[model samples]
Target: LSDPFVIIELLPRHIFSSCVEQQTVVHKRTLNPVFDECFEYSVTLEQCRAEGAMILFTVMDHDVLTFNDFAGEAYLSLNQIPGVDRGTSNADNFHGLKEIELNLMHQRDREHPILKTLESRLGDKAAQDFMKKCRERVTNF
Candidate 1:
């Protein structure tokens, strides 16, 4: 298992195909590419203090030739979807919501054995009421 502090790529969107028009950079840092050339990567942030916490970030990719540099970057102008994750907010963010939760839910998915057992033990009426309360809680979030 990877250490918590050992930051690493969580997705394959780290690398992309762009037309290299400039110099002869020769180091392959691409995720799956075996090319003879790879760009020299570096980070040059001076200061990033958040609530007295010193932060350090890195330059994941930089394409000087394209106008879409912010394509893979974070954008904060989107609205949050409700009843999806108990919702995510900017203050604490949706940091607790996992990938699967954020990607929408499967309506017709089979129930787990635990869920079946609980439904049997709790009775359908009680389970329905509990689920209704859950949905209400999510909606009110």
Candidate 2:
């Protein structure tokens, strides 16, 4: 049994400084956890239209005595979201809610181009630190 939680990150394609992050409450002692939650980001429609803007969902197993373990991750592009591509649309104007189901990948793609680019940012302390934390979360068990 594992205590699982989810971290949601909104990231711009080329700018890491503007990243917005949120997390779900940990669901204790269950491999199958239901995180019925909603997160709203203070992002503009322009930001949503920006190329490569995406939301990353990372699931982690909570641990009291040691580092949390990575369970899985999913990525969704802002462009693909409903009401995002529509003109002059507000949440209230969007009558129905669109539910998105994503398949989680159990393993991290170490050789991904984005990961490589982030890894190459040796001069950027923030990027380096972010990558370091991500690397540390690689499943060892």
Candidate 3:
């Protein structure tokens, strides 16, 4: 039995300053949890077209006494999302219903260049602390 939840992040390529994050409510003791949630980010269409811009979904198991455990993760490119490149003139089209099923993966690039760059920033205590928390969330000990 596990308490599962999901963290969703909107990351723009090379623009770490504008990352947006959101999360879903934890569903108790269920392996299959349906998260009917929506998140909105204030970003321009150009930002969505930026190379490597993506949406990252990380699922974790909640623990009352200890830190949450990483379950899996999925990544979706911004360009792949519906209505991003098509313009948002029609609010209806922009907000049109589109469903996606992502195949979660257990392993992630721990030594990713971005992660290394973020870790190397010793001056920003907040970034350092955020990175530490991210690492802890993904680490299962």
- Per-model TM values vs. the true structure: 0.18, 0.76, 0.72
Candidate 3: stretches off by over 4 Å: 13-16, 86-91, 94-96, 108-134
Q: Give a tens-digit lDDT track for model 2, residues 11-118.
A: 753554566688999999998899988898777777887877788899999999988889888899887776686665555554586778999886556777887898
lDDT of 3 by residue, 1-141 (tens): 889999988764355456657899999989888998878887777788788778889899989998789888889987777666565534446455567779998647877787788888999776787588577767631
Question: Runs in model 2 with CA error above 4 Å?
Answer: 13-19, 86-90, 93-95, 108-130, 139-141
Measured with C-alpha atoms, the lDDT of residue 4 in candidate 2 is 95
Taking all chains together, the TM-score of candidate 3 against the true structure is 0.72
Candidate 3 has its poorest 10 consecutive residues by lDDT at: 87-96
Model 3's number of clashes is 0
- lDDT of model 2, residue 62: 91
Candidate 3 clashing pairs, residues 3+ apart or interchain:
none
Candidate 1, overall lDDT? Answer: 0.27
Residue 119 of model 1 has an lDDT of 46
Report lDDT per candidate: 0.27, 0.80, 0.77
Screening candidate 1 with a backbone cut-off below 3 angstroms (N, C-alpha, C), the clashing residue pairs are: 27-38
Error of 3 at 110 (Å): 7.4
